[model samples]
Target: MSYRSGFITIAGRPNVGKSTLLNALMGQKIAITSPKPQTTRSRITGIINDEAYQMIFVDTPGMHEGKHLLGKTIDKLAVNSIQGVDVVLFVTDRHLGKSETKILNYFKAISTPVILVINKIDLLKSKIQTDEIILSYINAYPFKEVVPISAASVTNLDHLKEAIYKYLPEGPQYYPEEMVTDQTDNTLMAEIIREKILYHAQEEVPHSVAVVIESITPNEEYNTVDVTAIIIVERSTQKQILIGSKGEKIKKIGTAARRDINKTLDTKIHLSLWIKVKKDWRNNPNELKRYGYQDE
Candidate 1:
Protein backbone atom coordinates (compact mmCIF):
# COMPACT_ATOMS: atom_id res chain seq x y z
CA MET A 1 0.00 0.00 0.00
CA SER A 2 1.16 3.54 -0.82
CA TYR A 3 1.73 6.01 2.03
CA ARG A 4 -1.70 7.03 3.38
CA SER A 5 -3.39 8.52 6.40
CA GLY A 6 -5.17 6.26 8.92
CA PHE A 7 -5.82 5.55 12.58
CA ILE A 8 -3.27 3.99 14.97
CA THR A 9 -4.49 2.77 18.34
CA ILE A 10 -2.25 2.76 21.47
CA ALA A 11 -3.00 -0.19 23.75
CA GLY A 12 -1.27 -1.36 26.92
CA ARG A 13 -1.71 -2.15 30.59
CA PRO A 14 -2.62 0.62 33.01
CA ASN A 15 0.05 3.07 34.27
CA VAL A 16 2.33 2.04 31.42
CA GLY A 17 2.51 5.73 30.40
CA LYS A 18 0.54 5.39 27.16
CA SER A 19 -1.14 8.79 27.61
CA THR A 20 2.23 10.39 28.32
CA LEU A 21 3.62 8.88 25.10
CA LEU A 22 0.74 10.26 22.98
CA ASN A 23 1.33 13.79 24.32
CA ALA A 24 5.01 13.52 23.38
CA LEU A 25 4.27 12.35 19.82
CA MET A 26 1.81 15.22 19.28
CA GLY A 27 4.11 17.72 21.08
CA GLN A 28 1.11 18.80 23.18
CA LYS A 29 -0.96 17.42 26.01
CA ILE A 30 -4.30 16.38 24.52
CA ALA A 31 -5.06 13.49 26.92
CA ILE A 32 -5.16 13.71 30.69
CA THR A 33 -2.48 11.88 32.70
CA SER A 34 -2.49 10.60 36.27
CA PRO A 35 -0.41 8.31 38.43
CA LYS A 36 -3.42 6.14 39.15
CA PRO A 37 -4.10 3.09 37.05
CA GLN A 38 -7.07 3.24 34.68
CA THR A 39 -6.86 7.04 34.65
CA THR A 40 -8.17 7.17 31.09
CA ARG A 41 -11.78 6.06 31.06
CA SER A 42 -12.52 6.79 27.38
CA ARG A 43 -10.81 6.71 24.00
CA ILE A 44 -9.00 9.98 23.08
CA THR A 45 -8.07 10.68 19.44
CA GLY A 46 -5.23 13.05 18.47
CA ILE A 47 -4.22 14.14 14.94
CA ILE A 48 -0.54 14.26 13.89
CA ASN A 49 0.28 16.65 11.02
CA ASP A 50 3.48 16.25 9.01
CA GLU A 51 4.47 17.08 5.45
CA ALA A 52 4.68 13.45 4.45
CA TYR A 53 1.75 11.97 6.42
CA GLN A 54 -1.26 12.59 8.58
CA MET A 55 -1.66 9.99 11.36
CA ILE A 56 -4.52 9.83 13.83
CA PHE A 57 -3.54 8.30 17.18
CA VAL A 58 -6.18 6.84 19.51
CA ASP A 59 -5.20 6.59 23.19
CA THR A 60 -7.24 3.87 24.86
CA PRO A 61 -7.88 2.86 28.45
CA GLY A 62 -5.55 0.27 29.90
CA MET A 63 -6.41 -3.42 29.53
CA HIS A 64 -7.27 -5.43 32.65
CA GLU A 65 -8.90 -8.77 33.53
CA GLY A 66 -12.24 -8.13 35.08
CA LYS A 67 -15.98 -8.69 34.58
CA HIS A 68 -17.29 -5.72 36.56
CA LEU A 69 -19.66 -3.53 34.62
CA LEU A 70 -17.09 -0.72 34.32
CA GLY A 71 -14.09 -2.98 33.72
CA LYS A 72 -15.88 -4.92 31.01
CA THR A 73 -17.05 -1.70 29.39
CA ILE A 74 -13.55 -0.14 29.52
CA ASP A 75 -11.85 -3.25 28.14
CA LYS A 76 -14.42 -3.53 25.36
CA LEU A 77 -13.84 0.06 24.32
CA ALA A 78 -10.05 -0.45 24.24
CA VAL A 79 -10.38 -3.64 22.20
CA ASN A 80 -12.96 -2.20 19.80
CA SER A 81 -10.77 0.81 18.98
CA ILE A 82 -8.06 -1.49 17.60
CA GLN A 83 -10.24 -3.04 14.92
CA GLY A 84 -9.61 -1.87 11.30
CA VAL A 85 -6.81 0.49 12.37
CA ASP A 86 -3.70 0.80 10.22
CA VAL A 87 -1.41 -0.18 13.12
CA VAL A 88 -1.54 -1.06 16.82
CA LEU A 89 1.09 0.17 19.29
CA PHE A 90 1.20 -2.02 22.40
CA VAL A 91 3.22 -0.40 25.16
CA THR A 92 4.71 -2.06 28.26
CA ASP A 93 7.01 -0.96 31.05
CA ARG A 94 10.35 -2.62 31.81
CA HIS A 95 9.10 -3.14 35.35
CA LEU A 96 6.07 -4.95 33.91
CA GLY A 97 5.76 -8.63 34.79
CA LYS A 98 2.96 -11.18 34.34
CA SER A 99 0.38 -8.56 33.44
CA GLU A 100 2.21 -7.99 30.19
CA THR A 101 1.73 -11.63 29.27
CA LYS A 102 -2.01 -11.42 29.86
CA ILE A 103 -2.47 -8.32 27.66
CA LEU A 104 -0.55 -9.82 24.72
CA ASN A 105 -2.54 -13.05 24.77
CA TYR A 106 -5.55 -11.08 23.50
CA PHE A 107 -3.74 -9.29 20.63
CA LYS A 108 -1.26 -11.96 19.55
CA ALA A 109 -3.71 -13.34 17.01
CA ILE A 110 -5.32 -10.08 15.94
CA SER A 111 -4.98 -9.13 12.27
CA THR A 112 -3.61 -5.63 12.80
CA PRO A 113 0.18 -5.40 12.86
CA VAL A 114 1.30 -4.96 16.50
CA ILE A 115 4.28 -2.75 17.36
CA LEU A 116 5.89 -3.63 20.68
CA VAL A 117 6.73 -0.34 22.36
CA ILE A 118 8.97 -0.73 25.44
CA ASN A 119 8.53 2.53 27.32
CA LYS A 120 10.23 3.95 30.47
CA ILE A 121 13.76 3.22 29.37
CA ASP A 122 15.09 6.13 31.43
CA LEU A 123 14.59 3.96 34.50
CA LEU A 124 16.52 1.07 33.00
CA LYS A 125 19.87 2.63 34.17
CA SER A 126 21.88 0.81 31.49
CA LYS A 127 21.84 0.18 27.75
CA ILE A 128 22.43 -3.57 28.18
CA GLN A 129 19.28 -3.92 30.30
CA THR A 130 17.22 -2.06 27.69
CA ASP A 131 18.55 -4.39 25.02
CA GLU A 132 17.65 -7.42 27.09
CA ILE A 133 14.12 -6.16 27.67
CA ILE A 134 13.70 -5.51 23.94
CA LEU A 135 14.75 -9.08 23.15
CA SER A 136 12.27 -10.45 25.69
CA TYR A 137 9.35 -8.71 23.99
CA ILE A 138 10.49 -9.97 20.58
CA ASN A 139 10.51 -13.56 21.82
CA ALA A 140 7.03 -13.13 23.27
CA TYR A 141 5.15 -11.82 20.20
CA PRO A 142 5.59 -11.58 16.43
CA PHE A 143 5.73 -7.80 16.58
CA LYS A 144 5.90 -5.65 13.45
CA GLU A 145 8.46 -3.42 15.17
CA VAL A 146 10.33 -3.40 18.49
CA VAL A 147 11.03 0.17 19.62
CA PRO A 148 12.19 1.33 23.07
CA ILE A 149 11.62 4.80 24.44
CA SER A 150 10.67 6.85 27.51
CA ALA A 151 7.38 8.71 27.21
CA ALA A 152 8.12 10.95 30.19
CA SER A 153 11.41 12.20 28.57
CA VAL A 154 10.24 11.84 24.95
CA THR A 155 13.06 9.48 23.93
CA ASN A 156 13.34 7.30 20.81
CA LEU A 157 9.83 8.20 19.62
CA ASP A 158 11.03 9.04 16.10
CA HIS A 159 11.89 5.40 15.53
CA LEU A 160 8.44 4.42 16.68
CA LYS A 161 6.87 6.89 14.20
CA GLU A 162 9.02 5.57 11.39
CA ALA A 163 7.93 2.02 12.24
CA ILE A 164 4.27 3.07 12.08
CA TYR A 165 4.66 4.56 8.57
CA LYS A 166 5.91 1.26 7.19
CA TYR A 167 2.60 -0.45 8.04
CA LEU A 168 0.03 2.35 7.50
CA PRO A 169 -2.53 1.63 4.78
CA GLU A 170 -2.61 4.07 1.88
CA GLY A 171 -5.64 6.36 1.95
CA PRO A 172 -6.80 9.97 2.03
CA GLN A 173 -6.43 12.17 5.08
CA TYR A 174 -9.07 11.54 7.73
CA TYR A 175 -8.70 15.01 9.33
CA PRO A 176 -7.65 18.48 8.16
CA GLU A 177 -3.88 18.94 7.88
CA GLU A 178 -3.89 21.87 10.26
CA MET A 179 -6.08 20.08 12.81
CA VAL A 180 -4.59 18.69 16.00
CA THR A 181 -7.56 16.84 17.46
CA ASP A 182 -11.24 16.06 16.88
CA GLN A 183 -12.32 16.58 20.51
CA THR A 184 -15.02 19.24 20.86
CA ASP A 185 -14.21 22.48 22.69
CA ASN A 186 -16.68 21.72 25.44
CA THR A 187 -15.29 18.23 25.88
CA LEU A 188 -11.81 19.66 26.02
CA MET A 189 -12.84 22.00 28.84
CA ALA A 190 -14.26 19.15 30.90
CA GLU A 191 -11.17 17.03 30.34
CA ILE A 192 -8.93 19.85 31.46
CA ILE A 193 -10.85 20.07 34.70
CA ARG A 194 -10.72 16.34 35.12
CA GLU A 195 -7.00 16.34 34.51
CA LYS A 196 -6.46 18.83 37.33
CA ILE A 197 -8.59 16.78 39.71
CA LEU A 198 -6.72 13.61 38.80
CA TYR A 199 -3.32 15.21 39.19
CA HIS A 200 -4.25 16.64 42.56
CA ALA A 201 -6.04 13.63 43.96
CA GLN A 202 -4.19 10.73 42.30
CA GLU A 203 -5.06 7.24 43.64
CA GLU A 204 -6.23 8.65 47.00
CA VAL A 205 -9.56 8.70 45.16
CA PRO A 206 -10.66 6.54 42.27
CA HIS A 207 -9.92 7.87 38.80
CA SER A 208 -13.27 6.68 37.45
CA VAL A 209 -14.76 10.13 38.10
CA ALA A 210 -16.25 11.87 35.01
CA VAL A 211 -16.49 15.59 34.22
CA VAL A 212 -19.37 17.20 32.30
CA ILE A 213 -19.59 20.78 30.97
CA GLU A 214 -23.09 22.08 31.54
CA SER A 215 -22.96 25.60 30.07
CA ILE A 216 -20.61 28.30 28.73
CA THR A 217 -21.37 32.00 28.21
CA PRO A 218 -18.94 34.19 26.30
CA ASN A 219 -18.66 37.89 27.25
CA GLU A 220 -16.31 40.80 26.55
CA GLU A 221 -14.74 40.79 29.98
CA TYR A 222 -14.67 37.05 30.62
CA ASN A 223 -16.56 33.88 29.79
CA THR A 224 -18.55 32.32 32.60
CA VAL A 225 -18.75 28.58 32.00
CA ASP A 226 -21.42 27.24 34.33
CA VAL A 227 -20.28 23.64 34.61
CA THR A 228 -22.49 21.36 36.70
CA ALA A 229 -20.38 18.23 36.42
CA ILE A 230 -21.37 15.20 38.45
CA ILE A 231 -18.46 13.29 39.95
CA ILE A 232 -19.98 9.86 39.34
CA VAL A 233 -19.23 7.13 41.85
CA GLU A 234 -20.26 3.57 42.63
CA ARG A 235 -21.19 4.20 46.25
CA SER A 236 -22.35 6.83 48.71
CA THR A 237 -19.05 6.74 50.64
CA GLN A 238 -17.10 7.79 47.57
CA LYS A 239 -19.52 10.64 47.10
CA GLN A 240 -18.86 11.82 50.65
CA ILE A 241 -15.14 11.68 50.05
CA LEU A 242 -15.49 13.85 46.96
CA ILE A 243 -17.81 16.29 48.68
CA GLY A 244 -15.65 16.46 51.85
CA SER A 245 -16.56 18.13 55.15
CA LYS A 246 -18.30 21.44 54.44
CA GLY A 247 -17.20 20.76 50.86
CA GLU A 248 -13.63 21.93 51.50
CA LYS A 249 -12.04 19.16 49.40
CA ILE A 250 -14.29 19.79 46.45
CA LYS A 251 -13.70 23.52 46.90
CA LYS A 252 -10.01 22.92 46.32
CA ILE A 253 -10.80 20.77 43.29
CA GLY A 254 -13.03 23.51 41.92
CA THR A 255 -10.41 26.20 42.47
CA ALA A 256 -7.72 24.16 40.73
CA ALA A 257 -10.03 23.13 37.91
CA ARG A 258 -11.12 26.73 37.36
CA ARG A 259 -7.53 27.85 36.87
CA ASP A 260 -7.09 25.35 34.03
CA ILE A 261 -10.48 26.24 32.52
CA ASN A 262 -9.62 29.94 32.48
CA LYS A 263 -6.42 29.22 30.57
CA THR A 264 -8.09 26.86 28.09
CA LEU A 265 -11.13 29.09 27.49
CA ASP A 266 -9.12 32.34 27.61
CA THR A 267 -11.39 33.81 30.33
CA LYS A 268 -12.45 33.39 33.90
CA ILE A 269 -14.78 30.45 34.44
CA HIS A 270 -17.38 29.91 37.14
CA LEU A 271 -17.17 26.15 37.55
CA SER A 272 -19.76 24.64 39.88
CA LEU A 273 -18.63 21.24 41.02
CA TRP A 274 -21.10 18.70 42.37
CA ILE A 275 -21.08 15.08 43.43
CA LYS A 276 -23.91 12.64 42.72
CA VAL A 277 -24.42 8.99 43.55
CA LYS A 278 -24.74 7.25 40.20
CA LYS A 279 -24.79 3.79 41.85
CA ASP A 280 -22.09 2.02 39.86
CA TRP A 281 -22.57 3.97 36.67
CA ARG A 282 -19.66 2.14 35.11
CA ASN A 283 -21.38 -1.25 35.40
CA ASN A 284 -24.94 -0.17 34.85
CA PRO A 285 -25.47 -0.62 31.11
CA ASN A 286 -28.24 1.97 30.92
CA GLU A 287 -26.25 4.47 32.99
CA LEU A 288 -23.15 3.78 30.94
CA LYS A 289 -25.02 4.52 27.70
CA ARG A 290 -26.38 7.74 29.13
CA TYR A 291 -22.87 8.82 30.17
CA GLY A 292 -21.55 8.24 26.58
CA TYR A 293 -19.86 4.93 27.45
CA GLN A 294 -21.97 2.92 25.05
CA ASP A 295 -20.36 0.75 22.40
CA GLU A 296 -18.88 2.61 19.45
Candidate 2:
Protein backbone atom coordinates (compact mmCIF):
# COMPACT_ATOMS: atom_id res chain seq x y z
CA MET A 1 0.00 0.00 0.00
CA SER A 2 1.09 3.57 -0.67
CA TYR A 3 1.94 5.89 2.21
CA ARG A 4 -0.44 8.79 2.97
CA SER A 5 -0.02 12.07 4.85
CA GLY A 6 -2.06 15.24 5.32
CA PHE A 7 -3.09 17.98 7.72
CA ILE A 8 -6.47 18.05 9.51
CA THR A 9 -8.03 21.00 11.38
CA ILE A 10 -10.44 20.39 14.26
CA ALA A 11 -12.89 23.31 14.23
CA GLY A 12 -15.80 23.90 16.54
CA ARG A 13 -17.57 26.15 19.04
CA PRO A 14 -16.31 26.67 22.60
CA ASN A 15 -16.54 23.69 24.97
CA VAL A 16 -17.56 21.24 22.27
CA GLY A 17 -14.75 18.77 23.07
CA LYS A 18 -12.54 19.70 20.12
CA SER A 19 -9.44 19.51 22.27
CA THR A 20 -10.59 16.26 23.83
CA LEU A 21 -11.13 14.73 20.39
CA LEU A 22 -7.65 15.85 19.35
CA ASN A 23 -6.12 14.24 22.43
CA ALA A 24 -8.05 11.02 21.90
CA LEU A 25 -7.08 10.81 18.24
CA MET A 26 -3.42 11.38 19.07
CA GLY A 27 -3.69 8.89 21.99
CA GLN A 28 -2.10 11.51 24.24
CA LYS A 29 -2.82 14.96 25.63
CA ILE A 30 -0.95 17.70 23.77
CA ALA A 31 -3.69 20.32 24.31
CA ILE A 32 -5.15 21.55 27.59
CA THR A 33 -8.89 21.04 28.15
CA SER A 34 -11.40 22.31 30.70
CA PRO A 35 -15.15 22.65 31.17
CA LYS A 36 -14.85 26.41 30.76
CA PRO A 37 -15.40 27.97 27.39
CA GLN A 38 -12.42 29.39 25.51
CA THR A 39 -9.94 27.33 27.51
CA THR A 40 -7.84 26.97 24.37
CA ARG A 41 -6.51 30.31 23.11
CA SER A 42 -4.08 29.12 20.44
CA ARG A 43 -3.46 26.54 17.74
CA ILE A 44 -2.10 23.21 19.05
CA THR A 45 -0.72 20.58 16.71
CA GLY A 46 -0.88 16.82 17.45
CA ILE A 47 0.79 14.34 15.10
CA ILE A 48 -0.03 10.64 14.61
CA ASN A 49 2.38 8.27 12.85
CA ASP A 50 1.38 4.83 11.59
CA GLU A 51 2.80 2.30 9.19
CA ALA A 52 0.53 3.46 6.37
CA TYR A 53 -0.07 7.17 7.08
CA GLN A 54 0.98 10.29 8.97
CA MET A 55 -1.81 12.57 10.17
CA ILE A 56 -1.08 16.07 11.46
CA PHE A 57 -4.04 17.45 13.42
CA VAL A 58 -4.37 21.09 14.38
CA ASP A 59 -6.59 21.78 17.38
CA THR A 60 -7.69 25.39 17.10
CA PRO A 61 -9.32 27.81 19.54
CA GLY A 62 -13.10 27.61 19.57
CA MET A 63 -14.76 30.15 17.29
CA HIS A 64 -17.01 32.62 19.07
CA GLU A 65 -17.98 36.30 19.38
CA GLY A 66 -15.16 38.33 20.90
CA LYS A 67 -15.52 40.53 23.99
CA HIS A 68 -11.85 41.63 24.09
CA LEU A 69 -8.76 42.00 21.91
CA LEU A 70 -7.47 38.61 23.02
CA GLY A 71 -10.73 36.84 22.28
CA LYS A 72 -10.98 38.42 18.84
CA THR A 73 -7.44 37.44 17.93
CA ILE A 74 -7.90 33.81 18.89
CA ASP A 75 -11.22 33.62 17.07
CA LYS A 76 -9.45 34.73 13.93
CA LEU A 77 -6.85 32.05 14.45
CA ALA A 78 -9.52 29.32 14.48
CA VAL A 79 -11.16 30.55 11.30
CA ASN A 80 -7.91 31.07 9.44
CA SER A 81 -6.68 27.57 10.32
CA ILE A 82 -9.29 25.82 8.18
CA GLN A 83 -7.74 27.10 4.98
CA GLY A 84 -5.14 24.91 3.23
CA VAL A 85 -5.72 21.86 5.43
CA ASP A 86 -6.43 18.57 3.69
CA VAL A 87 -9.42 17.80 5.93
CA VAL A 88 -11.52 19.71 8.46
CA LEU A 89 -13.13 17.98 11.44
CA PHE A 90 -16.22 19.95 12.50
CA VAL A 91 -17.00 18.91 16.05
CA THR A 92 -20.23 19.55 17.97
CA ASP A 93 -21.91 18.01 20.99
CA ARG A 94 -25.51 18.90 20.19
CA HIS A 95 -27.90 19.66 17.38
CA LEU A 96 -27.26 22.52 14.98
CA GLY A 97 -27.05 25.75 16.97
CA LYS A 98 -26.11 29.34 16.21
CA SER A 99 -22.42 28.73 16.77
CA GLU A 100 -22.38 25.60 14.61
CA THR A 101 -24.26 27.41 11.88
CA LYS A 102 -21.75 30.21 11.87
CA ILE A 103 -18.92 27.70 11.45
CA LEU A 104 -20.83 25.93 8.69
CA ASN A 105 -21.14 29.20 6.77
CA TYR A 106 -17.37 29.40 6.63
CA PHE A 107 -17.29 25.95 5.03
CA LYS A 108 -19.35 27.21 2.11
CA ALA A 109 -16.43 29.30 0.92
CA ILE A 110 -13.79 26.59 1.14
CA SER A 111 -13.24 23.53 -1.02
CA THR A 112 -11.63 21.49 1.73
CA PRO A 113 -13.50 18.33 2.78
CA VAL A 114 -15.13 18.53 6.24
CA ILE A 115 -16.18 15.60 8.42
CA LEU A 116 -18.90 16.22 11.01
CA VAL A 117 -17.78 14.62 14.22
CA ILE A 118 -20.57 14.47 16.83
CA ASN A 119 -18.56 14.22 20.02
CA LYS A 120 -19.73 13.42 23.57
CA ILE A 121 -22.10 10.72 22.46
CA ASP A 122 -21.51 9.06 25.78
CA LEU A 123 -23.81 11.67 27.29
CA LEU A 124 -26.70 10.83 25.02
CA LYS A 125 -29.51 8.50 26.11
CA SER A 126 -30.08 6.42 23.01
CA LYS A 127 -29.14 5.68 19.42
CA ILE A 128 -32.20 7.57 18.14
CA GLN A 129 -30.99 10.70 19.83
CA THR A 130 -27.59 10.34 18.18
CA ASP A 131 -29.16 9.93 14.76
CA GLU A 132 -31.26 13.05 15.31
CA ILE A 133 -28.17 15.09 16.08
CA ILE A 134 -26.42 13.79 12.97
CA LEU A 135 -29.42 14.57 10.74
CA SER A 136 -29.54 18.14 11.97
CA TYR A 137 -26.03 18.86 10.70
CA ILE A 138 -26.05 16.79 7.51
CA ASN A 139 -29.17 18.68 6.43
CA ALA A 140 -27.46 22.03 6.91
CA TYR A 141 -24.36 21.09 4.89
CA PRO A 142 -23.10 18.15 2.89
CA PHE A 143 -20.29 16.77 5.02
CA LYS A 144 -17.72 14.40 3.62
CA GLU A 145 -18.61 11.96 6.44
CA VAL A 146 -20.55 11.95 9.71
CA VAL A 147 -19.09 10.23 12.76
CA PRO A 148 -20.50 9.85 16.27
CA ILE A 149 -18.10 9.08 19.10
CA SER A 150 -17.32 9.92 22.70
CA ALA A 151 -13.88 11.47 22.90
CA ALA A 152 -13.59 10.95 26.63
CA SER A 153 -14.42 7.25 26.29
CA VAL A 154 -12.37 6.68 23.13
CA THR A 155 -15.29 5.15 21.26
CA ASN A 156 -15.49 4.70 17.49
CA LEU A 157 -12.25 6.62 16.98
CA ASP A 158 -10.72 3.92 14.81
CA HIS A 159 -13.55 4.39 12.33
CA LEU A 160 -12.93 8.12 12.31
CA LYS A 161 -9.25 7.50 11.58
CA GLU A 162 -10.12 5.32 8.63
CA ALA A 163 -12.42 8.03 7.28
CA ILE A 164 -9.69 10.65 7.63
CA TYR A 165 -7.12 8.38 6.02
CA LYS A 166 -9.38 7.94 2.99
CA TYR A 167 -9.01 11.64 2.18
CA LEU A 168 -5.22 11.94 2.58
CA PRO A 169 -3.02 11.90 -0.52
CA GLU A 170 -0.13 9.54 -1.06
CA GLY A 171 2.83 11.54 0.22
CA PRO A 172 6.00 11.31 2.31
CA GLN A 173 6.02 11.73 6.09
CA TYR A 174 6.15 15.40 7.16
CA TYR A 175 7.58 14.73 10.63
CA PRO A 176 9.73 12.06 12.20
CA GLU A 177 7.97 9.02 13.69
CA GLU A 178 8.98 9.95 17.22
CA MET A 179 7.63 13.52 17.26
CA VAL A 180 3.98 13.79 18.42
CA THR A 181 3.56 17.55 18.66
CA ASP A 182 5.11 20.84 17.56
CA GLN A 183 4.83 22.70 20.91
CA THR A 184 8.07 23.58 22.69
CA ASP A 185 8.85 22.56 26.26
CA ASN A 186 8.30 26.06 27.69
CA THR A 187 4.88 26.45 26.04
CA LEU A 188 3.75 23.00 27.17
CA MET A 189 4.82 23.63 30.77
CA ALA A 190 3.12 27.03 30.84
CA GLU A 191 -0.10 25.53 29.51
CA ILE A 192 -0.04 22.75 32.08
CA ILE A 193 0.15 25.40 34.83
CA ARG A 194 -2.77 27.30 33.29
CA GLU A 195 -4.83 24.10 33.15
CA LYS A 196 -4.54 23.68 36.92
CA ILE A 197 -5.76 27.23 37.44
CA LEU A 198 -8.76 26.59 35.21
CA TYR A 199 -9.72 23.63 37.37
CA HIS A 200 -9.25 25.39 40.73
CA ALA A 201 -10.20 29.03 40.10
CA GLN A 202 -13.82 30.15 39.97
CA GLU A 203 -15.99 32.44 37.83
CA GLU A 204 -14.00 34.93 35.74
CA VAL A 205 -10.65 34.28 37.37
CA PRO A 206 -9.62 31.43 35.05
CA HIS A 207 -10.23 33.41 31.85
CA SER A 208 -8.29 36.38 33.17
CA VAL A 209 -5.15 34.38 33.91
CA ALA A 210 -1.95 33.84 31.83
CA VAL A 211 1.09 31.80 32.83
CA VAL A 212 4.74 32.45 31.82
CA ILE A 213 7.76 30.37 32.74
CA GLU A 214 10.55 32.73 33.74
CA SER A 215 13.44 30.36 34.29
CA ILE A 216 14.10 26.61 34.22
CA THR A 217 17.48 25.77 35.77
CA PRO A 218 18.77 22.27 36.36
CA ASN A 219 20.27 21.47 39.75
CA GLU A 220 22.82 18.80 38.90
CA GLU A 221 23.94 18.42 42.50
CA TYR A 222 20.43 17.35 43.60
CA ASN A 223 19.41 15.95 40.19
CA THR A 224 16.37 18.20 39.99
CA VAL A 225 15.20 21.30 38.10
CA ASP A 226 14.22 24.58 39.75
CA VAL A 227 11.57 26.53 37.81
CA THR A 228 9.92 29.91 38.31
CA ALA A 229 6.57 30.84 36.75
CA ILE A 230 4.63 34.08 36.84
CA ILE A 231 0.85 34.01 36.67
CA ILE A 232 -0.66 37.23 35.24
CA VAL A 233 -4.21 38.31 36.07
CA GLU A 234 -6.23 41.39 35.26
CA ARG A 235 -7.09 42.49 38.79
CA SER A 236 -6.04 42.11 42.41
CA THR A 237 -9.42 40.57 43.25
CA GLN A 238 -8.73 37.71 40.85
CA LYS A 239 -5.32 37.20 42.43
CA GLN A 240 -6.89 36.98 45.85
CA ILE A 241 -9.29 34.31 44.59
CA LEU A 242 -6.41 32.27 43.25
CA ILE A 243 -4.43 32.69 46.46
CA GLY A 244 -7.46 31.83 48.65
CA SER A 245 -7.49 31.95 52.46
CA LYS A 246 -4.04 31.43 54.00
CA GLY A 247 -2.57 30.81 50.54
CA GLU A 248 -4.34 27.46 50.27
CA LYS A 249 -5.80 27.79 46.78
CA ILE A 250 -2.55 28.79 45.07
CA LYS A 251 -0.71 26.09 47.00
CA LYS A 252 -3.13 23.44 45.75
CA ILE A 253 -2.78 24.68 42.18
CA GLY A 254 1.00 24.69 42.38
CA THR A 255 1.16 21.21 43.84
CA ALA A 256 -1.11 19.76 41.17
CA ALA A 257 0.79 21.57 38.39
CA ARG A 258 4.13 20.37 39.70
CA ARG A 259 2.96 16.77 39.78
CA ASP A 260 1.82 16.89 36.16
CA ILE A 261 4.99 18.65 35.08
CA ASN A 262 7.11 15.90 36.58
CA LYS A 263 5.12 13.18 34.78
CA THR A 264 4.86 15.02 31.45
CA LEU A 265 8.46 16.24 31.35
CA ASP A 266 9.87 13.06 32.90
CA THR A 267 12.01 15.07 35.36
CA LYS A 268 11.99 15.90 39.02
CA ILE A 269 11.66 19.65 39.65
CA HIS A 270 10.73 22.41 42.06
CA LEU A 271 8.01 24.81 40.91
CA SER A 272 7.38 28.30 42.28
CA LEU A 273 4.28 30.26 41.25
CA TRP A 274 3.85 34.01 41.65
CA ILE A 275 0.68 35.94 40.97
CA LYS A 276 0.72 39.48 39.50
CA VAL A 277 -2.08 41.88 38.52
CA LYS A 278 -1.76 43.52 35.10
CA LYS A 279 -5.09 45.41 34.99
CA ASP A 280 -7.06 44.50 31.86
CA TRP A 281 -4.20 42.92 29.98
CA ARG A 282 -6.60 41.13 27.65
CA ASN A 283 -7.62 44.44 26.11
CA ASN A 284 -4.06 45.72 25.78
CA PRO A 285 -2.47 44.61 22.52
CA ASN A 286 1.04 44.90 23.97
CA GLU A 287 0.12 42.78 26.96
CA LEU A 288 -1.55 40.20 24.73
CA LYS A 289 1.60 39.91 22.62
CA ARG A 290 3.77 39.59 25.73
CA TYR A 291 1.53 36.76 26.96
CA GLY A 292 1.92 34.81 23.66
CA TYR A 293 -1.51 35.51 22.12
CA GLN A 294 -0.48 37.68 19.17
CA ASP A 295 -1.23 36.93 15.50
CA GLU A 296 1.47 35.16 13.56
- Candidate number of the best lDDT: 2
**Can you give the TM-score per candidate against the true fold?**
0.90, 0.98
Off by over 4 Å in 1: 1-3, 202-204, 219-224, 264-267
Worst 10 residues of 1 by lDDT: 217-226
Clash pairs, model 2 backbone = none
Candidate 2 lDDT tens digits, 217-287: 99999999999999999999898999999999999999999999898878898999999999999999999
* Candidate 2 local distance difference test against the native: 0.93
Could you tell me how far off, in angstroms, the CA of residue 138 lies in candidate 2 after the best superposition?
Answer: 1.5
